[model samples]
Target: MIDSSANSPIVRLVGVEKKLGRQKVLKGVNLEVRAGENMVIIGRSGGGKSVLLKHILGLMQPDAGEVWFRDQNLVKLSEEQLVPLRKETGMLFQNGALFDSLTVGENVAFPLRERGNVNDAEIRSEVTRALKIVDLPNQEHKWPSELSGGMRKRVALARAAIARPALMLYDEPTSGLDPVVSDSINKLMVRLGEELNMTSVIVTHDMVSAREVGDRIAMLYEGKIYIVGEPRDVIESQDPIVHRFVNGISDASDAIF
Candidate 1:
């Protein structure tokens, strides 16, 4: 699924727009993430950050414009046709979607077994590797209910990465974890890009996470990417809104005092 030698943007969103009922969730989003790049997006709550992630995952389609994977336009593909493309992109949801009925190994094995035709021995081997990658190799036989919040997140990460996707989309990957655990996840993200050469798109509220893992940072405000560049550049910008948003300046730029 991943060929590092192939160059070009692995994922691109061109003039994309989406609406939910009477509300507009995204307005003409245009962005591109190149191969093996780590792009982090930051935005206030309810600012359509989550909605935009869903669009790329094809969990929801845009009402207007295109979501592309290099040359393949995802918007035009049927459910069956999109399967292979999806397999190349792994999504770590905000809430780890673990099957409570299954053990940690089974949960990690879920995607592989459902979407792949691997043999039983290979499946077990892959499951062990995934757990080891997350530093949870000992939790293989434990149920979801037995794990802590951080452990659950690690399990989700393991599952998303088990297939060794070309692209990894993380939705609040470090949300519920402590500073130490969050820092570990951040370092792992950096390693994924540097060592494994995997492209990553991360949506996060944690500014620290943004700075740690991002090769570049983009901020979404009013349903558009208001700023895009190096982490410190975007965070320390004189673009009043950028400064205000990052530093929590509450004055309304859309309104005149």
Candidate 2:
């Protein structure tokens, strides 16, 4: 559980702005993800949700303002300087991003291998525990091609959590999943956040999953965070803009792309 009064923010974006080509994605966005809390970022399709996640990961630098992880300013760090900080964070891509050449076990164990200190015995043990956490115990030998979409997502979750990073970033974790599978994934995310004591930032448009996993929900609209509040408050919002979004009431302007 997160302490609402906690002053520590594991990640903080202050006046962040970004542009891809001529279109601006993030426009002076400011947000704070308190340590050990689950923060869900929700918005319409192509609304810069994934771009925001990339900024958090230091995979993309903001054109202006600052992105801070703990005391380190990510925007100021070089790739070499960012390595240790990157290791302290884990991310689940929207597509699972598992290597097709690797087995499930190998995939889960990739981080450990990259660290290069853990022995095979410890890697096997940690892999087993990680897989079990995702409820995929003893199925490591299977290739990515052999797994269902849901199973692939679960394996990706296992791999993301195996490192026990201080922070986790999930991009569209429940996208393309059936309702049942999405719920299961949501539960797993919550469980993993608790077990790992991680601060999580999940970028997704799924309100059900957002309500299920987020301690706080932030709605991104027109390149800004329109609101940040508890799940009930955001979902039950009376504002027309938020209401239209949360209730899926589309506007003609929303059809612009």
Candidate 3:
């Protein structure tokens, strides 16, 4: 029972390639993320997970290959042309990436403010609603330094979703939290995806978080997607590389190594 829009993927990377300095970070990587689905990308450090996300965000263009959003080939579009597309997408960085000087409410309203059409009161109302969705009701006056790690992350997530973006990209959403906090973040992601009706792409190495939030998991290795499957399928995979990853084994002979 896949989404009817599944036939039209929201994001598709066709043989994407990128090189940074002396290393080829993405070597003909290919993937398709369907609309209204939570697609998680998992890999070791330096395996090009973030790089791939950057490509989708139009922060980077592949040296060769096409990156498509809906029907548009993003690589062919100029930066000016990509602005509307970027606005329709939201990104949660590894860090909260909030402006230290901005209050939580202001942080959530940043995007709306940038658009310059919404009045102050409307921005305030949207900010309050987004904050409430993240379960941080009436905490708009708090500063980033005053909030806990989990709260800061939730604020960041609220900011990302404030625009009601059609696509949401999360980078290592649970990177620096305790187990209980991590689970909370995981549940929040699932809930947001359901309630907002937005397609989500998460980049992380945390298997538990991936299992909890992902509808389909893609494993990046050697700058390419080595495998893509459901969480249970990934866990039970016979592929040595997947097995090694699931079991947290390090070996020279691993395919992903």
Query: Which candidate has the highest lDDT of all?
Result: 2
Candidate 1 stretches with Cα past 4 Å from truth are 1-7, 252-257
Candidate 1 similarity to native, TM-score: 0.93
Tens-place lDDT per residue, model 1, 46-126, is 889889988888888999989998689889999998888898889998887889999999999988898767998999998
lDDT of each prediction vs. the true structure? Answer: 0.87, 0.94, 0.93
* Lowest-sum lDDT 10-residue window in model 3: 248-257
Give a tens-digit lDDT track for model 3, residues 23-83.
9999999999999899999998888999999999999999999999999999999989999
Candidate 2, lDDT over the whole model: 0.94
- lDDT of predicted model 1: 0.87
Better candidate by TM-score, 1 or 2: 2
In angstroms, what RMSD does candidate 1 have relative to the true structure?
3.1
Candidate 3: regions farther than 4 A off: 1-3, 252-257
